[model samples]
Target: MALKYVEEYRDGTLARDLVKKIHSVSKKKLRLMEVCGTHTTSIFRHGIRSVLPKGITLLSGPGCPVCVTAQKDIDAFVAFARVKNVIVTTFGDLMKVPGSSSSLTKEKACGADVRIVYSVFDAVNIARENKDKEVVFCGVGFETTIPTIAAGILMGIEGKLDNFSIYSANKLTPPALAALMETDGVQIDGFILPGHVSVITGTDAYRGTFEKYDIPSVIAGFEPIDILQAILLLIQQNEAGKPALENAYPRAVSHAGNVKAKQIMNQVFEVCNASWRGIGQIPSSGMELKKEYQRFDAAIKFAMDMPDVPEPKGCACGQILMGLKTPEECVLYKKKCTPMNPVGPCMVSSEGSCAAFYRYS
Candidate 1:
């Protein structure tokens, strides 16, 4: 048999059948927001848009982690990299994302001691060994990755590593979705929700995106058939006039999510107001390391003074994140910005809007 959601979900015949069904049932023009970065990548990678009905419009939201990271956050990360005897640690995606003046990659090339790690735990290990230098993890992620950071914090606490700290840019998904729904630039009939984030945060987290806005949400998987099936589910909901959450990826997600991981996150992080790259400060959407984890807070340890972040000149990343424009609409998209040298994080992250647009179509 096929490997559950993996092989079974990618079935070409199933995808074709579902797409045909979507076309047959969907008579009116509908705007659906795929509120996950992976969905954006998959839509492009699979050429799903090519065969889609002209009435159905898929809008990419503020889902990509690196793209949503504000300019001030980048400045804060690079500021840490510039300090003497400080070992800056981050995931690979953060290295190329541009700050106001520079990026972590440029600092690394200049021998600024930037190290890439698989997880936050790897950063803690560096702090244990490199006693002479302070190790700061340039942590960036959404709900799916926050639990990993929480796990690392637990490890750090158990080991009592004094030298280790994390500069977390962690965020929740729903509030940003709510923010988008409130804005005039976006209007959607349904949402193809993210699968991975649902594993930790669960189906309950998406209820607000539906109940308040009256939009149907289908928590979708990465594969071709899975996405198509979710669209069908949305069409069914739209016809019935019911805006509800249906977990299409039932294998990994549940109504209640991972309780143990949520506990770990609750212990270390508290919700706080935070800014996004294109979007301004969204109230109580971001997580800050709590009072109990003060010793591990790199923002306090470094005393970084990053100014209020500014948008890049003529960059449509903000508009793109708000669903007002696509990457193709940006003047600087391919002219001044590219994968290698991105003026904005949308070009920097592989999951980023511009990168996905350029790569797939």
Candidate 2:
């Protein structure tokens, strides 16, 4: 029964029907951006583009946390790794992301205690085990992961774990969508919003952006059918001249979202201006620990202030994220950048647009 249920969304007959519907209704040259890294990987992995009408173009947005993380934050992580008696914990995707001078992987190879943790809890555990050393978790994620990080901080408080801290590079989704609308030369007809993010933030979270831009927007899952259905909805809205914010993945997302998760996240972190890797700073797009929770802020605890540094000269990750350019348009994409050795974070991260293009395009 479980297998059947999972396969239902992947059924070839259903997918073909949706693809035909998309082709039938898609008249205008629509540019829809999927604002999730998982969606980008899923689109390529399922060959969704191959089946879509040439009139509809899918653009990858700055959805990957690692890909969107600012260069200064990456440098800060590298700085943390270099500190004495410090255990720098992070997700595996960030290991290869090139900082200004060094990366966590390089620091680890040179005897720095940089550990890859599956979750913030694992970093907490490391702090629990090594009470004498400072364990700093590299907090990089969206709404889906922030609550867990907040819970991890609570756990640390209960256990009296003073050595645990997190350098938050966490980003919010809605502000980014607004910023995209304001960006010059970014022509997006509709948005295939992130399902995972919507699950936490709910449909209401996008209400402001939707009302302001009046763009056709649909929250979609990563499955082939889910993506195809979202594309069809956007195309239908575009063709009918009625732009609406619809939730295509109603099974997992709600209008109010997970209230408890948002409450917990708010309890620990507050909204602040945040910088993106390619794009500059977007107001109120970042989450920082609250005043009461300042003790757990790694940046404050360690005085690790990294200066703003320009990205690699030829890297166009910022442009790619903004839909202004594609990975192929970047001069360093395949020539000097690959998964093994990346010139930009877009190539290093698994959900990065360049990595997706390299693997499946």
Candidate 3:
């Protein structure tokens, strides 16, 4: 069959067949976690929860870029936006993530210039259009999105776009995944590894997760079939008392990953201590623009101070992000922390567990 865009991946009949197989193979109660924001959104978008058997439980994790983004960073973005001749451009989800006592949305209402972007390229274009304004892009996402961000930087450099900059908050996947697994919080029987992220980082990057913890890790696609098949593979592993790494999305992901992109990443950034809103500080999970590209580093350009921002009083976003609690567990999730007036980032970002739960649950 020929490949297309969205429809090529989302095969509904195949998904149903796989779901039936998952039900047949899964004997014991299998609690699986999908550690990708895209997967979370797909699960909700496709009504995946309703189709699943009662014996299987799917949990959310710290996968969403906006959800995992530390409040201090959002504050820093707000700070930059407030500066004269600076316009903050970011993905829509970031506008509402609470920072200090306020958010970018609140700041926008109070007249701190903030604009939404579909991609880093869009932000760059906006900078060119508004040459007098210092357009600082709020760079947030996992490996899947970082390549484009890096490409944008090179484009900026090539074009000599002096008005453009990036407040990079890009994070690594395996390190954060390991941190979640290390704690005695959630009992994740197996992991439906993020397929998009796996395409960039590869199956080799996650070999340690399987080897270290005897955890079955399967790189899964966003399609319902892919998710069900991954669960079946995991269940088979668990039943046989064997833990291993598998890739269900081989069409996109290879064992080795994208070498050229990794090279660009290595050249541009280095590992550093990263703060996840709920997951706390995971060592060497974040990327900082290297000294060679210090001129492009927004943090250095603006002299941004990352203060310890507190989570909202009644919000359980932290607990939700850890998979220790659901969005429903949070008193503020649907009430105070909603998409319209999101008290937390999770509720704002569609990929975020809270947003998924709020939208479909």
Candidate 4:
């Protein structure tokens, strides 16, 4: 029965029917952007682009957390790794991401105590075990992860783990969407919003951006059927000359989203201006620890102020993230950059659009 439920969404017949509907209705030259890295991976993995009409072009957005992490933030994480008696814990995807001068992977090779952790709780546990050493978790994510990081901080407080801190490069999704709409030369007819983020923020999180831009948006799950249905919806909305914020992944997402998770997140963090790897600073697009939780902030605790640096020359990661260029269009994509050796964060992250394009395209 479980197998049946999973297979139904991947059913070839159902997918084919949806593809046919998309091709039939997609008459205009609509350039839709998928605002989640998972959606980009699912689209490429399932060959959703190949099935869709040529008129409907799907562009990847600044959705991957690691991909969009500012260069200075990466530098800060690297700097943290170099500090004396400091153990830098981060998600595995961030290991190879090049900072201004170094990366955690390189620092680890040079005897820096850099550890890859699956969860923020794991980092907290590491701090608990090594009370003598300072454990700084590289906090990089969206609404989907902020709550867990918040919970981990609360755990630290309960245990009185003074050795633990988090360098939050956390970003919010809605403001970034608005920034994209305001940027010149960015042509997006609709948005295929992130499913995982929507599960936490609910459909209501996007209402402000939706109302401001009045762009056709749909929250979609990371499945072939889900993506195809989202594409069809976007095409339908464009063809009808009507724009609406719709939730196609209603199974996991709701109007209010996960209230408890949001409340927990709000308890620990507050909004701030956050910089993006490719995109510049967007107002109130970042989350930092609150004044009461300032003790848990690695940036404030260490007084590490990393300067804004230029990205690697000839790397179109910023342009690519903004949907101005595809991976193939980048000069360093297959030549100077590969998954084995990434010049930019976009190629290093698992859900990165460049990685997806390289793996599948």
Please tell me which predicted candidate would have the highest lDDT against the true structure: 2
lDDT of 1 by residue, 1-361 (tens): 5455577777788888898898888876788878888999988888898878898888888889889998999999999999999999999988999999999999999989999999988988998889888999987889898988988888888887877888888888999888888888577788899999999999998886678887889999888887888888888888777777899999889998998888889889989987888888888789989998988989888777588866889988988887789888999988899997798788988888799888888
By lDDT, the better pick of 2 and 4 is 2
Residue-by-residue lDDT tens digits, candidate 2, 245-320: 9999999999999999999999999999999999999999999999999999999999888899988998999999
Candidates 2 and 3: which is better by TM-score?
2
Which ranking of candidates, highest TM-score first? 2, 4, 1, 3
Give each model a TM-score. Answer: 0.96, 0.98, 0.94, 0.98
Leading candidate by TM-score? 2
lDDT values of the candidates?
0.87, 0.95, 0.84, 0.93
Residue pairs with backbone overlap in model 4: none
Clashing pairs in 2: 278-318
Better of 1 and 3 by lDDT: 1
Q: Which portions of model 2 miss their true places by more than 4 Å?
A: 1-5
Ranking by lDDT: 2, 4, 1, 3
Which runs of model 4 end up more than 4 angstroms from their true locations?
1-5
**What TM-score does prediction 1 earn?**
0.96
For residues 1-361, write the lDDT of model 4, one tens digit per residue: 3554456778899999998888778789989999899888888888888888888889999999999999999999999999999999999999999998889999999999999999999999999999999999999999999999999999999999999999999999999999999999999999999999999999999999999989999999887888899989999999999999999999899999999999999999999999999788899999999999999999999999999998899999988888999899999998999999899888999889999999998
Candidate 3: tens digits of C-alpha lDDT, residues 39-128: 999888888888777978888888889988888888898898789989999988788787877788888898888999899999889988
